[model samples]
Target chain A: MKLEDATPIIQLGEHLLVSMQGDLDDRAVLQLESDITRSVSETQATGVLLELSGLTIIDSFIARVIARLAGMIRLLGAEVVVVGIQPAVAITLLELGIGMQHLRTALNAADGMALLHEIRE
Target chain B: MVLAIESPESVCSIDSEASLVTVRARVRATAVDLGFGIVDQTKLVTAASELARNVLRYAQRGRMIIEELDNGDRRGVRVTFEDSGPGIADVELALRDGYTTGDSLGIGLPGAKRLVDELTIDSRPGQGTTVVITAWDS
Candidate 1:
């Protein structure tokens, strides 16, 4: 499935922003990784901001895919930041033993963009 | 003496990726009906997602049963997943973190265990597997 059909990838001044809303099935999650990675390289973005406030749950599979996406974007020379993790999801992720230390994160979209800019500098 | 009351059980078939989403929604609705708090609801839904996916991944297809429980003082939700696939060879290893035979992160079983109040697994090498998880209102 095309990335646009699942989630839109918008370009914002050298950074690409993708907002994930609602429940995304396993196929969509995997598609997002490949789509985002390609968009980063094609756009030559300096950073990528993933907005995840609309996601109610992040299972192990989703978490692993997100982490892997971050690593892939970094290899393409762009930093990735995840923002808008709910308090409960954060607690559950920790309990699930997925710290996601390799990825940078912020509380919301504004903060995430700012962090991305700081990292790009 | 506290009497236990159970609501009518609902079952969802897990035969495709879309079924995974359906199961999570069903569990979330049941959790809400049981008066589970936000955190508890999220934990239960997340655990349901993991186990449902396991059914699709290992057995190729399975079914999940959701039921509401009340013991006069406490309310809870229980989800049971059953699949007729190649059963787990090592239940203990399967429940450990970072142990997987497929192309997954290997945290589904153990992680689901950590998210709820109770998790039980019954599997035979060649017969099938059954996993049940329960989370009480907190």
Candidate 2:
């Protein structure tokens, strides 16, 4: 799959927002990871918000990848906040025992950005 | 080449990460076509994904079947995954949460079981493994 197939990352000032829409294959996830990591340096963004409200499924692979992505972004000096996880996805993650403790989460994009601002300040 | 079954449903081969993607998409679409809601669709699709990934990671290649199920007034989607790799040595231990033989999160088996209405696993050490999952409309 092309890089375009993955959701685009929107830049709002110093923070970047990536909202996932439908089910993403492993390729798309890897593409997004490389794209976002590159954007972190190219745009010099201080925070990144991953919006997962549109995704209903959070398989073990995807969850593991997201966790690794968060770590990569942090190494690039940007805080990552995952937002808008559905109830089902949340339950699935909990049952899977993948709390993603290293990453922060928000109820929605607005709150996620707010939390980002708090972390930055 | 992608193989097509003569029946109403179809089976896809999972040999690479790319094929796993195809299986996931096909299962999700099949669940939706069977009139499953978003939540149920997600569950089945997720379950399929985990199992398919296992096949690629462990067995090198496998086959997945996606078919519609009808039981009088109830309708559901059923998916079967078969792999001819080193079978599980401990089925009971593998079914329990937090028991992973590989370097994974240990959620593929137990997590999949919770997501669907029915799950059956048959395996013989050094032979192969097969998993069947069924989710009914609520």
Candidate 3:
């Protein structure tokens, strides 16, 4: 099978922006580790913003990865925020208890950015 | 190197989707015996439970296929699950983490694929879904 790709983007700002595309498969998860590590390191962002609008599902394994990512970002003196999570996706994440620790979620990008701004002050 | 290992006992032929977590515990521990970590085992078991539960909930009945790699090159397991349910409307949309026909959290396939090294999904609207998952420890 062809390995799933990770569509991650990094920008310089108060919030580190990263988006994941394609299936969040094991390979993709592994790739995300390196991508996040690099992106979080080079950016001056104090918070991490995740856009899950493109993601339609939320498996437990992926939730674990997200939890781990959140922990990793916190170690860098930053926090993680999730956006565009559908109701069903949110339910699954809740079941897996993925983001119970210091996770801030938003209904849209605007809300996510606003939350970031709120945290900055 | 063809590492083909099969366990007939690992097959859980239940139709209750709500009982999935119980089965997950059973299967994950078995998979762990085959050289998987606690985290990896939990992921695989959870993924399997979600997939199998879909079968029970949507299709009402199905079979779970479990296979492990004996290849000297690597240590892994493959599970091919088949269900004769109402079928998926849109595979791409369904592949998304939140798109669900039922009231589930809609993370079964997406989450399952993420937990394993390899994932293959084939389904039709009325035919059913055949999901193949591969987990590796190598």
The top-ranked prediction according to lDDT is 1
Candidate 2 per-residue C-alpha lDDT over A1-121 given as tens digits, one digit per residue, 9 for 90 to 100 = 6454569899999999999877677888888889999999999999999999877688998898899999999999999999999987777676556688777998999999999999989
Q: Extract clashing residue pairs from model 3.
A: A56-B96, A56-B97, A56-B98, A57-B96, A57-B97, A57-B98, A58-B97, A59-B111, B3-B70, B3-B71
- The TM-scores, one per candidate, come to 0.94, 0.88, 0.53
DockQ-best of 1 and 2: 1
lDDT of each: 0.89, 0.85, 0.69
Q: How accurate locally is residue B113 in candidate 3, as Cα lDDT from 0 to 100?
A: 64
Under CAPRI classification, how is model 3 graded? incorrect
RMSD (CA, angstroms), candidate 1: 2.1
At residue B115, give the lDDT of candidate 1: 96
Interface RMSD of each: 0.7, 2.0, 12.3
Point to the candidate with the largest DockQ: 1
Model 2's DockQ score: 0.53
Q: Give one digit per residue, the lDDT tens place, for model 2 in B41-61.
A: 777888888899988887999
What residue runs in model 3 are displaced by over 4 Å at the alpha carbon?
A1-98, A101-121
- Candidate 3 per-residue C-alpha lDDT over A1-121 given as tens digits, one digit per residue, 9 for 90 to 100: 1334447576746677777664454456667767786677777568888887676455654665777787888898777788886664565455444445566778788788888788778
Per-residue lDDT over B24-130 for candidate 3, one digit per residue giving the tens place of the 0 to 100 score: 65566667778876556656666676677677768888777677776787678788778888787777887787777876656776766666677787888788878
Chain B TM-score against the true chain B, each candidate: 0.94, 0.93, 0.86
State residue A62's C-alpha deviation in candidate 1, in Å. 0.5
